[model samples]
Target: MNGVLAKYSLNTVCNEAGCPNKGECFTRGTATFLIMGKNCTRNCRFCKVAKAAPEELNPEEPLNIARAVREMNLRHTVITSVTRDDLPDGGAGHFASTIFEIRHLCPDVTIEVLIPDFQGDYVALKAVVDANPDIINHNVETVPGLYNAVRPMAVFERSLELLARVKERNGNLFTKSGFMVGLGEKEEDVIALLTALRNVGCDIITIGQYLQPSREHYEVVEYIHPGQFKKYEEIAQTMGFQYIASGPLVRSSYYAEDGFNYLKRANATAGGDV
Candidate 1:
C-alpha cells in the first residue's frame, strides 16, 4: 500500500494522522487519500498533521490521486485534506478536480470527501458541492463547548452549517460528520451534538474515542466504554440517522465502505436516489 501511494506521489490521512487502522485498511486494500498537501495551515491542537506554511499545490495532484485510486482498486475512496486556509478557495477547486479525475478513471468507485470548513466560504463550499461526490463529510470533531480548547480554529456552528448547506444544495447526497468522545464532554453535550447534526439533515454519523497524539496535544479526558458507544449508536438511529459507526476506533472513514453500502441499500428500499 505504501509503495502504491508513493508511486503516485500521494498521501493518505491514514499515514499522515497515524491512524491505528492503517495496517488493517491497507491489508484490506483501502485508504483515505489525503490531498493538497500534508502540512496544514491550521494549528488545531487535536490534529497530528504538521502546521507550517503549506507548499505550493501540485497541479498534478488531482490526476495522481485518481491514478492511485485506480491502482488501489478501492470500492469506496474517502478523500480528505489538511486545512488550507491560505488558499483563496481553500483548495475546493483541487477537490473538485480530484473528484472529476477519479470519476474519469474509476467510474464505479464511490467517492466520499471529508472536507475542511473552507473557512466558511460558501463559494468555496459550492465548488465541492457542485462536484457531486456520493458523500460529503465535514466533521464537527467535538462538542461545541470544547471547540476553543479542542479545536481552537474551528467553529462548531460553522461546521454544522457546512453539513446543512450540502443537503440544501443536493438533498440526495449522503451527508456525514463525526465527533470524538473522551474530550471532557458531558453526556448531554454529546446528545446535543447529535441532535444538531440530525437537525441539519446529516444522514450518517461516526462517534470515536479521542486519543492524544502526543504529550503536547489535547489530553484524553476519559475512555468511553463500548456500552456507551453502543448507546450512542442507538440514540442516533432513533433520531433518523441512516447509519452510525460508533466505537473506540471508529474514525470518520473507518468502515466507510460499509456505511456507503448501508445507505445505498436503504435508499434503494426507500425508492430514493443514492
Candidate 2:
C-alpha cells in the first residue's frame, strides 16, 4: 500500500496525522487519501499535518488518485485534504474533480470525502455536494468551547452549517461528522455537541480520543476509558444517527466502509436508491 501511494505521489492522512491505526489499515489494503497538498493553511494546534503555506493544487491529482484506486482495487475509498484557505473556493472544485474522476475510472467504488468547512462558502460547499459522493464528512474536531484553543480558525457553527448544507443540497448523500474527546471537555459538552450534529441531520458520527501530536501541540487532557466511548456510541444511536463509531483509536475514516455499507443495506431494504 505504501509503495502504491508513493508510486502515485499520493499522501494519506494516516501518515500526515500520525494516526495510530495506519499500520492495521494499510496492512488490510486500505487507506484514506489526502489530496490538494500536504501543507495546510490553517494553524490548528491539535493537528499533526504540517502548518505552512499551502501547496499548489496538482492538476493531475484527480486522475492519479483514480489510477491508484483502480490499482488498489478498493471497494470503498476515503479522500481528505488539508484546509486550503489560500484557494478561492477552498479547493472544493478540486474535490469535485477528484470525485468525478474516481467515478469515471472506478464506477463501482464508493467514495467518502472528509472536507474542509470551505470558510462557510455555500457555493464552494455546493460544488462537492453536486458531485454526489457517497458520503460527505466535515469534522467539528472538538467541542465548541475548545474551538478557540484547539481549532482557532474554525467556527463550530460553520462546521455544523457545512454538514447541514450537504443534506439541504442533496438529501441522498450521507452526511458525517466527528469530534475528539479527552480535550478537557465535560460530559455535558460532549452530549451537546452530539445533539447539535443530530439536529443538523448528520447521518453518521465518530468519536475518538485526542492524542497530542507533539510537545508544541495541544496536550491530552484525559485518556478516556473504553466504556465511556461505548456510552457515547449508545447516546448517538439513541439520537437517531444511522451509524456510530466510538473508541480510542477511531478516526474519521477508520472502518468507514462499515458505516457506508450499513446505510446502503438499510436504503436497499427500504426500497430507496442511496
Candidate 3:
C-alpha cells in the first residue's frame, strides 16, 4: 500500500489524521484517498493534519487516485480531503474530477466521498453532488457544544445543512455524518446530536472515541467504553439509521464497505432505491 500510494504521490486521511487503524487498513490494501493537498486551511483543534498555506493544486491528482484505486482492485473506496478554503470552489471541482476519474477507471467500484463543508457554498457542494458518487459523507466531528472549543472555525448548523442539502439535491444519494465521543459531552447531548442528524435525512452514522492526536491538540476529556458505544449504536438504530459503525477505533471511513452494503440491503428491504 505504501509503495502504491508513494508511486502515485497520493495522500490519505488515515495517515494525515493519525487514524489508529492505519496499519491494519494498509495491510489489507485499503485506504481513504485524501485529495486537494495535505495542508489544511482551517486549524481545527482536534485534527492532526498540518495547518499551513497549501501548495498549488496538483492537476494530475485525480488520475493518480484513480490509478491507485484500479491497481489496488478495490471494490469500494472512500475519498476525503483537507479543508481547502484557499480554493475558490473549496476544492469541490477537484473532488468531482477525482470521482469522474474513478468511475472511468473502475466502473464497478463503489465510491464514498467524505467532503468538507465548502464553507456553506451550495454551488460548490452542488458540483460534488453532480458527480454522483455512491455516498456523500460530511462529518460534523462533535456535538454542537464542542464547536467553539474543538472546531472553532466550523459552524455546527452549517454542517447539518450541508448534509441536508446533499439529500435535497439528490434523494438517491446516501448521506452520512459522524461525531466523536469522550469530548465531555453528556448522554443527552449525544442523543440530541443523533436526532439532529436524522432530522436532516442522514442515513449512516459513525461514533468513535476522541483520541488526542498530540499534547498540543485537544485533550481527551474521557475514554468512552465499548458498552457506551454499543448503547449509542442501539439508540441510533432505533432512530432509523440504515447503518451505524460504533466502536473505539471506528473512524468515519472505517468499515465503510460493510456499512455501504448494509445500507443497500436495508434500502432494498424497504423497497427504496439501492
Candidate 4:
C-alpha cells in the first residue's frame, strides 16, 4: 500500500518518533512521509532519529512519494523529514520537489508539509513555501530556556523565524507550528512561547504531551492530564489561532485530516466562497 514511500529515498517523522497515531492515520489512508534520507545531522535531546552521515538524494523520490500517496487513498497527507544539514540547500529542494509531485498525483488532496528549519536558510525556506502546499509546519518543540538544553543544535529563535518567514513568503499557505509540553517547561513559559508564535502570524498550533521514546532520549518530565490540555486549547484559541489542535494525543499531525478540513473551510470562507 505504501510501496512508493518505501521505495523513495526518504524517511518520515511519524516512523522516527514512534507516533501513537500511525496505525490510525495509515488505516484512515494518510501518512506523513519523510524525504531526503533518514540520517539527521543535528542532535536534539528528545528525538530518536539517527545522527550520522546522510546518503545521496534520489531523483526519483518525488515520483515514488506521489504514487504511493495516491495508492494509500490519502485525502490529506503530510510530508516531513529528519533534518538533513549535510545537504547544501538543507534538503529544501527535495521537500519542494516532493510537494510538487504529490500535488500532481493527488490534485484533490490537501498536503501539509512539516519541514526542517532549512538551517534558517530563508531562500531554502522560500523555495518550499513557493511550492504552495496547503499548510507549512515547523515545530518549535519546546520553550526557549529549555531549547539549548533540549535542542542544543537547534536555535529557538531560528525556528520561530522559519515560521515567520514562511508566512511572509506565502500569505495564503496556512502556517502551523507545535510545542511538546512536560519537558520541564513552566506553564508561563509555554504561554509565552505560544504568544510569540501567534505574534508571528501562525495560523494553526498543536500542543501535545511529550512522551520520551527511549532511555537514551529525553525522559518524560511530567505526564500532563487531559484537562490541562483543554485549558491550553482555550488559551491558544484566545491567542488568535485559526485552528488549535490540543490534547494529550495531539502530535503535529495526530489529527491530520481534521486540520486539512479546518483549513479548507476557513480558506473558502475567507475567499467568500462559503
Candidate 5:
C-alpha cells in the first residue's frame, strides 16, 4: 500500500490520517481519490494535512482521476478531499466537475463523495448535489461538547444540518455521516449523536476509532475496542440508520462499496428505487 500510493501522487484521507485500513483497501484494489490540493486552510487538531497556503488547483485532476478509475476498473469509488476554504466556491465546482467526468467514463460505477461542509454555505453544497452523486457524505467528526477542542472551525449542529439538507432536497439520495468515538465522548453522547443524525434524515452512519497521525496531533483518549463499535452499530440500527458500519478500523469511506451494496439490497427489499 505504501509503495502503491507513492507513485500515484494521489491524496487520500486514509493516508493523510494514517488510516489502519490502508493495507486492506489496497489489497482490494480500491482507493479513494483526494482532489483539489492537500494543504487545508483549517488547522484541526485531529487532521495531519499540512497547514499552508493553498496550492495550484490541477486542472487535469478530474481527467487523471477518471484514468485511475479506468485503470483500477473500480466498481465503486470514493472521492474526497481537504477543506479548501481559500477557494471562493469552497472547491465545490471542482468536486462536481470530477464527478461528472467519472460518470461519463464509468456509467455503471457507484460513486460516493465524502465532502467538507463548505463553511455551511448552501450554494456551495448545492453545486456538488446538483451533480447527483450516489451518496453525499459530510462527516460530523465529533459531538458538540468537544467542538472547540476537536473541530474549531466546524459547528456541531450545522454539520447535522448539512446532512439534513441533503435529504430535504432529495429523499432518494442516501446521506451518510461519520465521527470518531474515543476523544472523550460518553456513551450517552454517542447515542445522542446518532439520534441527532436520524432526526436530521441521515441514512448511513460510520463510527470508528480515532488514531493520532503524529505526536503533535490530538492524542487518542481511549482505544475503543471492536466490541464497543459493534454495540454502537446496534444502537444506530435501533435509531433507524439503514446502514451502520462501526469498527475500530472503519473509516467513513472504508469499504464504502460494501455500504452501497447493503444500501441497494435494503432499497430493493423495500421496493424502493436504488
Candidate 6:
C-alpha cells in the first residue's frame, strides 16, 4: 500500500496524521487517501501532518488517486486532505475532481471524504457537497474548551455550521462529524457537543481518545477507557445518531465503511433512509 501510494504520488491521512490503525488498515488492503498537498495551512496542535507552506495544487492528482483506487480494488475508498487555507476555494475543486474520477474508475465503490472546514466558506463546502460523495465527514477534533489549546485556529461553531450547511444543501447526504475525548473535557461537555451535532442533523458521530502526536503538541490529559467510549456511543445512539463509532483508537475515518453499512442496514430495517 505504501509503495502503490508513493507510485501515484498520493498521500493518506492514515500516514500523514500518524493514525494508530494505519498498520492494520494497510494490511487489510485499505487506506484513507489524502489529497490537495502534504502541508497544512493550519497548525492544529494535535495533528502530526506538516505545518508549513502548502505545495501548489497537482492537477493530475485526481486521476492518480482514481487509478490507485481501481488498482487497490477498494470497495469503499476514503479521501481526506490537509487544510489548504492558501487555496482560494480551500481545495474544494480538488476534492470534487477526485470524487468524480474515482466514481468514473470504480463505479461500484463507496466514497467518503473527511474534509477540512474550508474556513467556513459555504461556497467551498458546497463544491464538495455538490460532488455527491457517499459520506461527507468534517471532524471537530476537540471540545470547545480545549479548542484554544488543541485547535486554536479552528472554530467549533463554524465546524457545526459546516455540517449544518452540508445537510441544508443536500438533505439526502449522510453528514458526519467527530471529536476526540481525553482532552480535559467533562462528560457534560461531550454531551453538549453531541447535542450540537444532533441539532445540525448530523447522521453519524465518532469519538476517540486524544493521543498527542509529540511532546510539542498538546498533552493528552487522560487516556479514555473503552467502557467510557461505549457509554458515549450509547448516549449518541439515544440522542438519535444513525450510527456511532467510539473507542480509544477510533478516528474520523476509522472503520468508516462499516459505520456507513450499519446505517444503511438500520435505515433499510427502519423502512427508509434517515
Q: How close is candidate 5 to the true structure, as a TM-score?
A: 0.95
**Clashing residue pairs in candidate 1 (N, C-alpha, C atoms within 3 angstroms):** none
Tens-digit lDDT track of model 6 for 1-274: 9889989999888888889999999999999998988899997888899998889889999999999999999989999999988889999999999999999999999999999999889999999999999899989877788888888899999998999999999998898889999889999999998998999999999999989888998888888889989999999989999889998998888888898889788888989864
Q: How accurate is candidate 3 locally (lDDT)?
A: 0.94
lDDT of 4 at 104: 86
Clashing pairs in 2: none
Ranking by lDDT: 2, 3, 1, 6, 5, 4
In model 4, which range of ten residues has the least summed lDDT?
1-10
TM-score of 3: 0.98
In model 6, which runs have C-alpha deviations exceeding 4 angstroms?
none
Query: Each model's TM-score?
Result: 0.99, 0.99, 0.98, 0.94, 0.95, 0.97
TM-score of 4: 0.94
Provide backbone clash counts, one per model: 0, 0, 0, 2, 0, 0
Each candidate: what lDDT? 0.93, 0.95, 0.94, 0.83, 0.86, 0.91
Candidate 4 lDDT over 101-143, as tens digits, reads: 9888789888888988988889898899889888899989899
What is the number of residue pairs that collide in model 3? Answer: 0
lDDT tens string, model 3, 131-237? Answer: 99999999999999999999999999999999999999999999999999998999999999999999999999999999999999999999998999999999999
Output the worst ten-in-a-row residue range by lDDT, candidate 3. 265-274
Residue 108, candidate 3: C-alpha displacement in angstroms = 0.3
The residue ranges of model 3 lying beyond 4 angstroms of the native Cα positions read none
lDDT of each residue in 1-274, candidate 1, tens digit only: 9899889888989999989898999899999999988999987888899888898999999999989888888889999999999999999999999999999999999999999999999999999999989999999999999989988888888998999999889887889999999999999999999999999999999999999999999998899999999999999989999899999999999989999998899889989877
Model 6 shows how many backbone clashes? 0
Task: Rate residue 109 of model 5 by lDDT.
Answer: 86
Model 4 misplaced stretches (Cα beyond 4 Å): 1-10, 270-274
lDDT of 5 by residue, 57-95 (tens): 988787667767877789998999888998888899999
